[model samples]
Target chain A: MTPRPQQEPTCHGEDYAPFERALLNDYQHELPLVPRPFAAIGEQLGVSEQAVLEALQRFREQGVLSRVGATLKPGAVGAATLAAMGIPERDLEQVAAIVSARPEVNHNYEREHELNLWFVAMAADDAALRAALTAIENETGYPLLDLRLVCDYHLDLGFDIQWTSANETDA
Target chain B: MDVSERDRRLIGALQAGLPLVRRPYAVIGEAVDMSESEVLRRIAALRDAGVIRRFGVIVRHHELGYRANAMMVWAVPEHQVDSLGERVAESPQVTLCYRRRPAPPQWPYNLYCMVHGRDRETVLAVRDELVARHGLEGMEHRVLFSGRRFKQRGARYLAPKQEAIGREANHGRA
Candidate 1:
């Protein structure tokens, strides 16, 4: 691997209000199951309901928060697999688009490896999921390395962020 | 628990997002023609039944300064997967750790864990620490760093049928 230049950090400390930090770190999981969920969050943070809503909305606009909803358990309602394909560098973009065009593909990422194009194919059931993967293989002309999850130890992707002193500003 | 038509519709509605409002349940209820209390009841019931895993803010790690992320796969003996997976999951740096069925002939890794950090160097240092601490120096492993994210979104389980219909309609147009 070649040495890469360090890139400047995108998120700054002043970007996070005290409440916003709490929302990102504390509320990553286990949102209150209430009629007015935002209101509950506000009460806990000592902020107004409107303020909570606005902050969340702003976060979404800024790409901080992807959504405010449930993180479904994998393979709970359907079937999925981590699949990879090795496409020549020249055909990478074309093959990636073909794979990404499928609605069953919720995640398609190019990674650094011989088998570079990695994606997760999700479907309503096992049969549908298999069909989707098969279709991708037929279309791409590249054999796929299909990896099915056998067991999960910890699948939570959410994590806390530590704001750096350089980025810190009075909230 | 069996998810009925009503529950499917509710899940579809909430899949994209919950309305950012004071009375989000009420807004969601209005969409499905259910009363606010009923929406609350069903959601709570679904949660208890494990149909809904968790309801919360979905933070984008990259936006939060976690620029370096790698999916580390290891070819561990089948017998050692469970114990090793547990240990890997216990690490704070590892957000996701699981045992997967490796594809033979081409792929031969069964254990997977996702490590995230502020930079590539940080992630590599943590990966080294994990390997040393877990005593997995002899295991065959590969680290794949994500390059371009082509697509990413919440799972669309209930909307598949609708999406299929939509696809057909678009096909006809083409």
Candidate 2:
């Protein structure tokens, strides 16, 4: 593989070493399934296996990498829904905490809109997913809007973090 | 393809993450009481079955400096949704594109795509480009920028036991 030209480190208040950039960009998908996966990654990046392992550990500690694991297809094993609720501005934080506390609510975010608190709840099945939504409604005292998925158009292969220089103007 | 009891246990064990080590599969095998080769075979079988969509590093985009995250929703006509969805998914700017049932009266937009950039302007620019290129201007749409991510983690699967363990360790947020 040809070495990428060393572009100027252009990021929004974040500086990633070249090795970190490679790990973030190249190895997001197609990780070798072997006894010594890190060794395989080391061979590709031309570094020792130990170096790869230590870098991954540091990335975990710094919250840069979520994990090196499987991203199961949505509804592959269970049911999930994108649920939202409108909370009074004063109680947004409190209501968010209540919603986020649920183990089934994997993603909870505050968006800019009337129905601000949005989250994705996954359960063992459709019945369990509905139960989780109902419980959230009861706990938060706010009506929950359950938006079930109709179709998925993209296969999530992870993001490409190597931004071109054209995107640097906004930075 | 039917899943065996052992496969379910293996999926439950892997839902959280693979242990970072020289022999992570061996470590997992010990927990699930399977040999290292058995564990590898089961994982491969699961992947082949499309149960595992992706297996690799999961990065936190916000921390990586793609901070301007916007969720764009459009109310496309029913006849055009299928083709338009495929087209929208082709744009490099759109990371996630999907269709969800729209709540009527209050919410009528169905098509959704997410764009992340270094700043809010960049994200909006991408959205505008898509709108113009796709002739989506006449369609009613809304751009919801994500704020204050209270919680984000890997999708917990299989058993409630795995979820219970995940609840204790849900500190990373973007």
Candidate 3:
């Protein structure tokens, strides 16, 4: 993999209001499954239903929230694999575009490693997954490292962000 | 479990996102031409059937002050991976953990775990503790911090016809 500059954390500073932060940190993992979920959130948070809806809308618009929906378990509905490819620097963008062009490819990232171009592909079944991987390998001309997940543990991406340095540890 | 055409449409609409409104189901039903009750019923059925995992807020970790994130891979003995993976995942600091196929000759790490924290140092500390606790001191491993995220989105599991249309669009662009 072509050596790229190490990435610094881009997300910093607490610019959001207290309610927004509370909504983000607390209500992220579980949104009540109700006819008026936002209303429930509002009732608990001491905010109006309209205020909760507006805050969520703003959060989604600002990229603070990806969505208000279900995170389908990998391999639950179909076959999926975490794949990586080692592409030459010159062909990185070309290869990445080719890989990302597939609709099944949900996540594509550039990591710091020899097998740089990493992505996750999901399809209707095993046959479709194999076909997609084979097509990507054939197009990119790079041997794909297909890593099927054996098991997922603690895969929750959402966590309570401690604004204070409560659990801060030295490097 | 087969999903009806209307249910497929609901899934497609939901994959995009549920609206932040008082009557979200009603709003979504209006868009998908389904009744509010029908949409609610279908969603419940989908959740029960395991098609939809859990309806919740998809938080952006980075945006929410999780600055440092590393995908750490370790080459553990094949037999020990399952047990070690469970132990490592029990830590709150380790957000994701799994056993993946190792790329031989170059990459020989089958066990992978993601550690996310407010800073690089915090993440590193967590990693060190995990390594020491798991007795993975002598193991060959590497921490690959995410440099740039090109794309991140929900997995699209629409109807086969919608999948075909998506492929066609991508092919046209290519």
Candidate 4:
């Protein structure tokens, strides 16, 4: 694993307007799935598909847009599992290497606390997801706090939810 | 930059359904009253705009017996967060890894990650190992698993034809 940079550019301050946030949050739904989807989106917004393209491109660069692809449900076609672990501040960098090295895990992030490292594993089946998780724990020695979703509601964590219009009369 | 009505219509069709045919573009064209080649060009344009990320299948997890799933949040030391963030992302079980800015005193954790699993036991087992290996015994964390799935849909964004919403006005309640 590479060494952690002394610091990362915080995704704060005036990163975007409420419009971009709303757009990022709901951009996927706006995407036209037709042959010429881009033009279709343009038609809806009264903007050229080119504008939508440019805006989305800018969003991607800003980290507000994770990806525009289909966010298919997990464990559907193949398999997936939720896993987490507490990483001591000192050893986090080293442990992250072990966790991220697995081919099954897709997304990972950092949070505050002892169980610092969190990630997910997708596989062809439940067994594979488990085996992979077990292997990760065994190798890393960090316990995984795996929480399986019995039910999901509005699981779409749209980053656009952050959008708050300045025009809101209350504000 | 501005988008047009035709583009919205096109996205609506695809979000509704990616025509399952040899020439899906041609089928979409027929529905919206456009030529297949024209549909294809428009789609390319949307791809450039980042509106349509990918043309892929929408899958269901429970149907395949992945009955359980959860969002696992972890607190890694600020220094080690990034490296660890990348490592956990490599796991297939882990999806949607990110480092959200946590709120004040109560949540000092600078790191947050997620994982999906078939059941609780499986998730716990995986969690334990991560704790031990990452040497995360000293931090605080939480696991907010999804209790129910209320609404999940393909892109519901359709720039209204009549109302012109400024960039800031666009939003959906989660």
Candidate 5:
């Protein structure tokens, strides 16, 4: 299929206001190590265990919630990274299929610009991840511009759309 | 927020905690006074809506011994972003890929994507393939690897009217 220029906002729900940002917030604490943690939270929210369960179902039913499982730090357990590519218009689909077929690749996105492709890599470690990149380079005949993360001034995004760092003088 | 009362109770519990026992549903039933089957059905509904993305283990990459990681950003041609994105994300190495309004002047590329691997070498190999396969010869990309992890966890689900509950999403893993 012929690819066309398109912009997809991942932070969708722009058409309609988010039902409540709070529901998506508050993961700072450890998940209840015990069984029936939901029951515990239900007591605090002044609702029934059933209510908590169903509400999550509904948020997911709507496009508000993304996942209800644990968010483990991939870096600690394994290795991962982010990268992008510059593909021609005609061969994007073929490339996408090939890329997704790999186990290491995960997040993928399309943008509007010269280097219009971007994605994240979560491999078991640095060597493995680099090896994967090399294999890709060999197949595609293009050197990947590896821009490793230097510092993350802001890591936790999305939840606090209105959050501002202490050094808000510049923006 | 607009869920039925029954749903409210179920969600409330889920938001608080999920049973980690063999019969998690049974424990949940005791709290909400519903059958395990009922709880499972409700979860299925949420997943269908793209709200509850899934019920799986949140992997701790570093703990799993994966040290090298970066946020690889790409700059594909505007016409090929979608197809390219699908391909880039196709690799299980990638965890996220969508679209972002690139920062002007500072950030030239608009199309953003990701790929995760064991180390820098593995990731670079896959990236190189895309570069050549897609014919991206002259493009800028940054593979920003993480040195410190401030926080990371499942996305919080807050309604529009409520105050977002901010928690320290990621704990120490060093």
Candidate 6:
């Protein structure tokens, strides 16, 4: 892992308007499944439909919000597994690029360990998943640790944003 | 449960995200040649079928100041995994929890959960509380803090080439 840098903690919410904060904090899930969903959200947020739409657009452009869409259950539409590889420090970048380029590989990270490069691989089926992992192994010339999930105990609730802690509101 | 061809098209259209328009479903319907009502119905059906686990705003935690995260893995007794995993997952501090196949002789930790906080000290404190609260003190565990993130994006169930383009267009990351 990269050593933790000594720096002042950034207050991410310093620039966000209350409406923007509410949109992010309150709507992580349970979006109204309606023809005019944004309008519905606007009703709850006490803003016009246009305001809601405009705010989301800005959030997207700023990369603060990923999307307003479905998060598919892992292995529901396809097979998936958590995979890791022990890449030599010198070659981590090259090997990581290869893994990241493959769209099948998602959530790739360099962790603080011998098996540093970790990622999640997904495909249409078990066979396709194996083939993808095998190709990565052959290309990278490193054995992969295929950790298939046995159970997902965490409910699908979205991550709760600690708004007060994340912001310097008093300042 | 098989996903229909139309459902696949819907998923493809949605992989980017719902457009920030008044009638976003109408926009999506136009893309897949689905009626606005039909699109909404399909989305609900998909959700009910457990295909769509969540449907709403997806925030980037790192950008939101929940930067420090650690993947905590524990090797608990086989019989106690289900009970312990449920407890760990129930903790609000733990963002993700799963029982994974442990690579034995080398990696013997099967239970996995992730804790995220604004900084390292907060993350470690959360882990400690979880460990103590769950009676997992004696268990063999390791906390693997995340380092450089190479790539992070939503799962691409469709062709990689197509979704990669859409991913970049939407700035999509999980």
TM-score of each: 0.88, 0.89, 0.83, 0.46, 0.44, 0.90
Candidate 6 residue spans exceeding 4 A from truth: A1-12, A165-171, B160-174
RMSD to truth, every model: 6.4, 5.2, 6.6, 17.6, 18.3, 5.2
Alpha-carbon deviation at B34 in model 3, angstroms: 5.1
Docking class of 2: medium
> Can you tell me which runs of candidate 3 are displaced by over 4 Å?
A1-14, A155-157, A164-171, B1-10, B30-34, B41-51, B163-174
**CA-based DockQ, model 1:** 0.59
TM-score of chain A of each: 0.87, 0.86, 0.84, 0.74, 0.68, 0.86
Question: In candidate 2, what are the lDDT values of residues A65-95, reduced to their tens digit?
Answer: 8888888776778788899898999999999
Candidate 5, residues B37-97, lDDT tens digits: the string is 7877765655444334434323334432345555666665667666766666555445555
lDDT values, one for every candidate: 0.79, 0.80, 0.75, 0.52, 0.48, 0.82
Worst 10 residues of 5 chain B by lDDT: B165-174
Q: Can you give the lDDT of residue A72 in candidate 1?
A: 71
lDDT of 3 by residue, B51-166 (tens): 67667777777766676778999999999999999899888777678888777778789899987787889888988999888899999989887766777877776646655443
Query: What level of docking quality does candidate 5 show?
Result: incorrect
The clash count for each model shown is 0, 0, 0, 120, 170, 0
lDDT per residue, candidate 6, B25-103, as tens digits?
Answer: 7777776788999999999999899888889998777766677878999998889999999988989888889999999
Residue-level lDDT of model 3, residues A1-171, one tens digit each, is 123343442333345567766787776556776788888888988898888878777666567688787776666666889998888879888888898888778889887888788999888678898999999999888888888888776555466566553334421
The order by descending TM-score is 6, 2, 1, 3, 4, 5
Q: How far does residue B170 in candidate 3 sit from its true spot (Å)? A: 20
